[model samples]
Target chain A: MTAGVTARTYMIVGAEPEWWYRDLVSCLQATFGTVLARAGVDPLSVLGAGWRFLHLPGDVRSEEFYYPCPADESGQIDLGSALAPHHQLHSRWWQPADENDVWREVRETLADNRLVIAAVDNFHLPFRPAYGDVHAAHLVVVYGLDETRGVVYVSDAMPPAFRGAVPIEEFLRSWGSANPSDVQDAFFSDSQIGRRCLDVRLDAPPAPLTPELLGSYLRTDVEAFTTATSTRTGLAGFDAFAAELVERCRAGDADALRELYPFGWGMQAQASLHGELLRRCGRQWNDPALAGAGRAVEAVAHAWTGLRFTGAHGLEDPRAAAADIAHHATVLRGKYARAVDAVGTTAARL
Target chain B: MTGIAMSSVKAGLCDPVDISGHRNNTAISAATETKAGAFNVWGNSFAAEYLPAGGSLVHVDGVPFEFPPVCDGPDNIRAAGQFIGVTPGRYDWIHVLAASERRCEDTIELSFADGSVDAEPLRISDFWAAPAWFGEVKAFESLVMHYPHHVQRGVPAMMWAQRVPVTRRAELTGILMPRNVALHVFAVTLQRHGQLA
Candidate 1:
């Protein structure tokens, strides 16, 4: 019997069915990384460093040709000229053909380790009008096939909707219909497609710390901030903490200075606070003082109070605060570096 | 253009000779005229002004009150101050105020110019106290009156002609005189029932 891999088990875990394409992508990348590692497969080697799904055009082409211009290819095929022959291909995935055949082709494409991306034309589903167009669909891995259900369980680059598990029938319909004049219905003949499949064992989803994903994890914090509970003071306490740090820096406190360094609390706070300050200050951040102050507060708040306190401060998400800190830290660090460089240059000249 | 100086003084009031008699004060009684609509007490009493001698009606404040050349007769001049009589029904009197100079402070008193005791001398103080008087009465109410002007320019100036509700007719006891300075006052009395003899 195969050892139970956590990543593989998580692949079957039910998720919000109606996740967006981007959300699914992020989840796949995250899950696949851990899963592949646990499966004894080097994720880096299989997935490649900085591996990303390339977007495909949602149009019909004159001919089928592998993308990234395969080294052995006879130059680039002009889409307008190739449209006729490409349409004549007997691939089941190409519509005006059988749906089951299309599914088989898609499955084969996934198994090939080639990235299969479908540009959904008029991507909105009939049941869910809000999903709008599935501009891009990237299949990262095929987990398994539900023979009884006739459904393919696949990891996608797109975020899963709240009602996860996109129906194979529905996905095919969208994928087949997205035929633009310049490109094919979906990316089938790409060199990268079916090139390398990673034998990754997926892991349990990580607790999302970023603001966008914070909603899934920190419901209470979001509610507290939205309702404006006095308990959740938002960056006010963080501001105070930052001020103390600044004071310590002014006073030449080695410990405080060390805390402010770009490593642990200081770096985290700076990144988180910078994001928060950028949002709050918006265009007002043209002034250095206002922007700096916003960043300082963001950093201090996140460092002293794990984003859980964001709820206490009437803030729905700590991720926003974290983002602010990060942005502010970056800006301040750049300025500080410049200042230091100027001072060093002057000293060297003297 | 030639400078035509207009001046007028009551028989009992001080008068300088050789002054052009362009200044004329006319009054219209409200007793016979029917009130056409609801007591629009706040409407402008002085709808238009006209100087028969043709020069702009230069207000004492240096602001010019544009009076079109439409007033061809004395009746139109009398109708200029006809707004005071605008009660819900026919009124026994219509107190009309006229400014003779441009700065707003030169007092104009209408009296029996011929020294005929038949015409009563209307006191300026009496006109100032009546509810039907023009302009704001309460010192503090004036501040409220200014609020609308602060909201927009020219609004308060237009609101200056609104009517006040008062029971008594104001009476002036002196001769009518138009000083070189502008004067804003209400002229009040019982309207004449028939044609004056």
Candidate 2:
């Protein structure tokens, strides 16, 4: 560590965070993936360890990085745990301690050799495709803060991927943007940026995944899907969610359609990753049933396209879209049932 | 060009199917007025300059295709349970130029000239800066994506060359596309089995 109390710059010693990304993932998983990589864990195995359906009614946020993470019994929200249920990952949202100096927490985190995931408005970030055109909430990795040079090093793995220095002023504006709604993008707008940042901590390194370990996780997930719980969970939970979605669409509730895009993303990304992981393990073990099960899970991911885009296109005149909306929802439900059955059977053997 | 050259020499190869009657969606747009094209929900579309001219002949992997008209009118079919009748013939594979709202794999039912029917897999990758996850060829790419209001750089829009197998030996008659709105088909060609064995 640098000796001087107020060093001009602070950066992690060896290398920048690995850019872990997939086409289906949101900024939420992309940022967490980078953090998990820096902690010496394979981001895919940890992030894709579990898959289940979760939609908290009236809890959806209009942000690109929105993920459905329900608060715990004690009312604590851990996005890290939500993303990586099988790993010892935890995350909390925080803002600058002092309104006068917003960089205080960021510099401290950098000094501690931890990368910060800051929420920024794409309209103000010059590297973002939406810069100066659309106000969408997004996430980026902040590796270093050079107060002396007036630059903030940032990394984003989304398309037109960028990794370089951003002027501190530009960064600040993006981080503090109101993210007002624009006609161009109705899905990811009208959310306040509020300079929120995630403080992620990998309390313990993940253990190497084994067949038995993965099997247990799969079993737990299957049981969760099969068992009826007080909260929205399992196939029953999905039924309730789907029913309400169709009913709301017929009633012309725009918010229901709006929430589906971002909320559905988390579920879709989880299924894709988990399915990919299971397929990899099945190939290594030469288990055809397991491989088929993985493919089934991937089908669940692909089915999300039908439902999500239907909601997206059907945003206006949702009443007109009700039939097709119900159609995709039913199709997606069938996919979930098939996938869960296949995964359950395979897990029993593994 | 090598692909196009190979297309001219191949024997009993896939004859490009003329399905102009099926074109119902416009996925390509001019930069001057980007709002005309609505390929996906975000009002993004492929750039016309980066693609073949309207009504041009193009080939990918030695397979011939009639490239759709660009920005002129309906250039693609946003699959919504559309059924297209094909020239009745025995075929080995069904090739298509397609892009999805996102990565998608759906089914397309093939009705044989006889009584047999089979559901073939139709997979298309995302046009919005995504790799072909289902082992498809990168057919065409617009280096810049067109948004509703402005041109977006760095995010390239892609069109893929994807194919589905015609395992049945009977002559093919028609294709019943899935009700998937996410899958967009620009052009299709039927490769006859006569070229093989």
Candidate 3:
């Protein structure tokens, strides 16, 4: 460890990389927490799960220059300026034109302060032009570099699969030759990973991804749908069918409404269909206003379906319209039940 | 967007071609490259060579389909127009053909809307899988139908899914984990039956 290296270096090296994109973001958040803790900043307040960071812009296909400080007196981070010592000391490196520039900027950044971070490119195994041809790119932290061993230790977001130090020269050459289109972004740090050269930890065991932890990574969209459906259905257990119906409606299934008309006479009938499910589940319609709005929408759909099916001639028969609306509503409810059940089964593991 | 909505109006069959016996024959070998901005539809196998922008050579129910100058030539075939305009509506009775077979007896009903195509009654026959590579070949001996959608939003811009019987082996292989399956479906709607301007 160097004089400026913090105790948190070993901690970051041990963490697992998350699989999903959101989980990956969470991993970044965790890293920031460690960084803030070392800086004597309250991790909770300054760096938590959803903290936003300043995004450095870069084009992978083009060799662009980046500067640490703002070109103007504003002292902002100017991406175009050359890398400097003070900038490097901050603990992270911005994207530079080439490997030579990355090395030079990293050295300067580290000299100013041990806090700097640099973004480095990690090459994958069995590389091919096809793999390099895509627009996807990965970001990793440069923890250390050993000149003699010719290795650059990286804290990759793609953990287990791509964590640890790689041959410095070979890594750079592979990175440089990568289809420029695939060069996404890099991370640099004046922290231990950036300055202290260490051996790539290939043998270091990976952290487990328990089911409980995986549940935490559930998609927000799925969660929102679940919550809404549960509230609307009021069923003690989640009604997969009703949820599917709502999803189909949200998906703009006009025929679904038409099919629902016959089962429910009017908007009130439709509301009851949703309301009864919720009531059976021991849930209350939390918002009366929303409940009223839902009824009104259902009424419009019921009336439209009736008119279309009965034709203008049949429009004179109010009974026929009512019967048609009820039939349609029943069909919609049936379809909703089936879809919800399927979706529930499919997503049950989550 | 408005034109897309208006263009949702379906056109009648200009020249209906039979598409039987094209699947599993490998009679046509064409290279398809997807590009940004405009879709490109080109193949080595074609009766008459016709080029169209914003279109790609797609495989539907084990059969390959070329758009614009539909089929192989300069006859001003405009079936690709279905994929051009938007407004997400279903179209019935979509068809495709290969260059090698002229019998054209193969018929498939394709319902397309919202950038996805579903080919029903088709089954997977054989597949190729190894380490990082995965590929599958599906064979549909019986009746084949297609339902496609032109997704302006949500998921893939263009998608096609087919169901076929397992008469033969389906082969699939790739390096990276395959994230998605690309299905070739048109995004045009049928406003009127057999009416094309």
Q: Which of the numbered candidates is closest to the native, going by highest lDDT?
A: 2
Stretches off by above 4 angstroms in model 2 are A2-6, B1-11, B195-197
- Return the TM-score for each candidate structure: 0.22, 0.95, 0.27
Docking class of 3: incorrect
True-vs-predicted CA distance for residue A93, candidate 1, Å? 13
Total backbone collisions, model 1: 84
Alpha-carbon shift of residue A297 in model 2 (angstroms):
0.8
Q: For model 2, what is the error of residue A286's alpha carbon versus the real structure, in angstroms, after optimal superposition?
A: 2.5
Q: Tens digits of per-residue lDDT for model 1 on B1-197?
A: 22222111111121111111232222111222212111111111222221222223422211122222222322212111212211122122323323211112112233332332223222121111122122322210111111100111121112122111222233322334322211233222223222222
lDDT of 2 by residue, A128-215 (tens): 8788888999999999888888899898988778888999999999999999987777888999999999999999987788889999
Q: Residue A31: error of model 2 in Å?
A: 0.5
Alpha carbon lDDT of residue A229, candidate 1? 27
For every model in order, the fraction of real contacts preserved is 0.00, 0.76, 0.00
Better by DockQ, candidate 2 or 1: 2
How do the candidates rank by TM-score, highest first? 2, 3, 1
Q: Residue-wise lDDT of candidate 1 within A1-350, one digit each (tens)?
A: 11213312222332312212210112323334334443444332222111011112222221112211111264433321111111111111222235344445444443443222233322333222213422222223444434445444544332222223556665555445433331211222121221212222122323222333222212322222124223212233233444444444444443332222212222232233233423343234243443343333333322222211111221223333343333333333343333223222322222
Q: Write the per-residue lDDT of candidate 3 for residues A69-141, one digit (tens) a residue.
A: 2234744333211111111112222445454555654444333333223322223322211222222222344
